[model samples]
Target: MPSSKPAFFFSSTQSVDNRLGDVFSFIWGSYAGLRELWWQVRGFNTQFPDLHISEIENKFLAGLPMPGGIDFKKLFVKTDWAEHEKDFSRWILFDVCTLYEGWAEKVCKDLFSSSTYERNAKAIQFPSGVRANRQVSGYPVAVNEANTSASTLMKDEFLPTLKKSYLNCWSFIDQHLLAYRFFKECRNSFIHSEGVVTQDIIDKHTELATIQAVKPSPFRNNFILPSQTLGQSIELNLKDCINFATIVRKLICTFDAALSVAMASEAILEQRIRNLVSNNPKWNNLPSDPAKREQRVHRMLAASRIPEPQNFANMMAWMQSKGII
Candidate 1:
């Protein structure tokens, strides 16, 4: 007896030009919608008892007469339905964490794809005319593909090579990873075991409980109810989900800025090289043969020590001093 109507209703039209921005907007919209829905449900229940239609409907539905001096009122009001609230919070938190992980994977792919860094790999040659061949891949493919946890991805793939300026950003993400893992476990338990709290789950929660303070400063604030026993379960509230969404937005912004900087720097370096080849009389006067032209450019670039353009500004300055630009 399945109903044709959907259990939930949501609609959005994302901008095609900015996928990452669209993701952030979607996350923000979802959080706001959840909050609005929660308040609406709370207010509806609060007003239900005052409405005469509710009592009439109840009597008609139950097929019972309204007895003398009987108070026909709902037992629960003010959003105090504990089980429903708990389930709602858990669902929201789980969705936010899952989306955050997907966003991180996209960032990894955008930053470390083969097309982005394959040419940057250093080539090594041996005396016997042998060269080493190493395959380049995106961060997700190059790192542990089996591990899908965002926390693990940060630790294994990003933290090791992140710049000092970006350490604060990494810390912001790290602070939430434990809570995200715990939420993931809770989601699994609910899905597989009807929300039964097992000993193993409790132990795992206990192990992850004390990595950091429950409150993530002013930036992100998520709660993990301390569970010390087998029967107890972790709890995430609406505020926790909202805070997590905020942190995720911050991570996306910071990572996008860093990637943009790297890309601009790369573009600047390439432009400098092109300018050098085009403007320098020596390189410009070289034979029009493609191979010879390439060889001359290579020799000129090598002599100017510009093989790997690490610092774009410094490289440009050096090239100008060497009359290569």
Candidate 2:
């Protein structure tokens, strides 16, 4: 007699649970680090008023050439503190973008892997000559590493396919994908150009330039070249970085909630299937062949016409109506 339990069920559920914890933990830790950096910047400003006053007065009165020959007298005088704030902002923006991209990749991989497991466990056949035909030993390589962009993942993968009930949980993050992209571009500019404000960088980020306070005003003043306009550079300030960090935190919360919903839904379905099999003596004495037993269970579940529940409440109601509770 076969057990009739799906072999992949337990492992798949556990994998999702563990990965969700890891993702949230990483996001929270990153947010904490960003806060610490913010405080450190404030501390530096408070402790070093003399540096700003002395440097600004000397550079102005002595007519010393400031960096890039930008006149200190015309610009706001706190050049040293402003430079520190700009550099810190760039650092935070780059790292936060990296964290976000990494999380997106991880979640996508987890979902695809789970879907693949379910299909294989049910022995669901795929069309011939399709990408599914590239399976290695009965498992398709569904982990998409090539196109990990947030827009692509949300539009093409996450939003459309996630259970309807979980969509609302992800809505806020989905709506802010453009903001994420802007940060990504900033990270790229810093890494590739060594923070140079080139015409190409300006053109690439023009859409985000209209955004007031994208960079800290004082920091922005320091970077504005005589030949360059305000929107022509890739400079950012500490305040801008802090605001972006808050956005990232919100995204993390939304994603965490969605994953929780998904996990609960999976658990409910698993329990329903188990109860169905356990309550039937026929299922208990399934065919000796494991493949045939699995097919029997799959057929029975499909015939029940009980669609997969989207959340715990839906699952409870369905189970109650079917006298499964």
Candidate 3:
């Protein structure tokens, strides 16, 4: 059954939004502290003058409890400071990219969790082109659709669905979407290909130009650039890590705010569609197919001496708004 009451896009993201801000604040603040530690280790010789950082730490730090009686010195001494520098940047890239992908997955889940989206998804006739891979053994068709859609978000051309559903908010951040996709490509390359931009990723990087172009550092004069040479690994510093991490963090929060504001209006608009379908005799007179229904609806609007909306969703919302439903 279709959702009876007007409910969608989450009943309230207020708690989620507030806590998200706090969480990111803690994360980036701690990241700053970690960053300082990185610098302190790098300049250890200059500050200590006599003792190496590994020497001081290894002598006294060994007294701490160890689950496996592991030597703490090995971690610092296994690789020189210069080697540690490269590893730090690569680790940060992997860590933040993982965070971004995880958060986006959660967002996808949340967006399609509503009863409205569930009913709408079920209505989709499967064995059709819209990613209907779920087996119908146990779960309902709608459940399968919703699951497939959420899981596939941002991996395929899933952003367009979000843009249509959350039109105004998505349109506002149009350029941000491009940038987000660009970073996602970088993340894929690093994670799947050992930090070397692959041949497939090269065409995408060339098209997006995000990795190809040099980015300015927020905290220093030094720049972050990914080497475009296809087979070689690129250099990534702390500044490079900071740039992507901060942008992804901001983009998520900004998108949440946008969703919160526009959801109620969109909910009302969606409800209007349900109302027209269930309550109106004119709707029953039309064929069950959407194209035929829309053509009939367009004609009805013209015959009523009213203007037709550009899309079926808009048409239904328009009719309700005009007191014609």
Candidate 4:
């Protein structure tokens, strides 16, 4: 039976079980809850069907009393949103990690799989420290050549592949991953060093990012640019991340379809073999053939769909040709 494991694969190093759990927790616990709060206070509206922009300023400012009497957290809870106060403040960070996990999973499955791309991603087999160090930390780890692991390749080449392969499987790669990377960096500072990341940091960097993304191109419409401000910047980044996830999911669906076709073909081949035996007169003369009976008894696979790894190579090549490899 074809294995149903690939669709569920998120990351190669991390167990699929762990990665999926994290995604569900982040989306439902943090993103969804905060979105609900945004909806109640300010009102939810969207120009683009899938794009939702909450009345954030109105919702936040409406509850504020200029004087000292009102507790912000207390007022937040009175509206039944108190439960998500912590998440509201930290949703950006949670999304950052969640999107990162999603992208990491696709990369592992698309680029590192032994069955696809025919690349060796496992640890190198050098016997000496000199060779080991060089091999392990080898530049262009893309393993475009046999006996190499592509994981160590420089970002320019690897990232393009990562993006393209992900695109083939998804509608778009959300720029949110880049934002999440920065968010994770900021989160680490707060968590590990007690460093402050203020609006200034986001504004300056976000403006620069806007320029880069806005550079003229035939495909310019594919990119979305946001204004420069800490909240706006972070929001834009988050959008990118969400878009990227959508792309990855799409690719998985494509691969699933291919697997179904392969399984159907296998069934057809099996049926043909049976027809050949029934029509031929040579074996009709002999007693009920044990070999034929054994062949007929071959197990029919369960009527379930699963990912077949054989398509990985074709997927990799297609992605690489599109500059996503």
The number of the candidate with the highest lDDT is: 3
**Model 2 residue pairs with clashes:** none
Give each model a TM-score. 0.41, 0.38, 0.44, 0.35
What lDDT would each prediction earn against the true structure? 0.44, 0.44, 0.46, 0.37
Error of 3 at 152 (Å): 29
Model 4 deviation from the true structure expressed as Cα RMSD, one decimal place: 15.1
Which has the better lDDT: candidate 1, or candidate 4?
1
How much is 302 displaced in model 1, in angstroms?
A: 32
Off by over 4 Å in 1: 1-84, 109-167, 171-175, 213-234, 247-325
Candidates in order: C-alpha RMSD to true structure: 16.7, 16.0, 14.7, 15.1
Which lDDT tens digits does candidate 2 get at residues 244-315? 655554444444333422333344345656666677756556566756755554455543323322243443
**Prediction 3 TM-score vs. true:** 0.44
Q: What is the lDDT of residue 66 in candidate 2?
A: 44
Question: Can you write out model 3's per-residue Cα lDDT over 209-286, one digit (the tens) per residue?
Answer: 543344541212223445566787755555665565555554454443333222333343345445655666766576
The segments of candidate 4 whose C-alpha lies over 4 angstroms from its true place after superposition are: 1-89, 95-139, 142-183, 189-241, 244-325
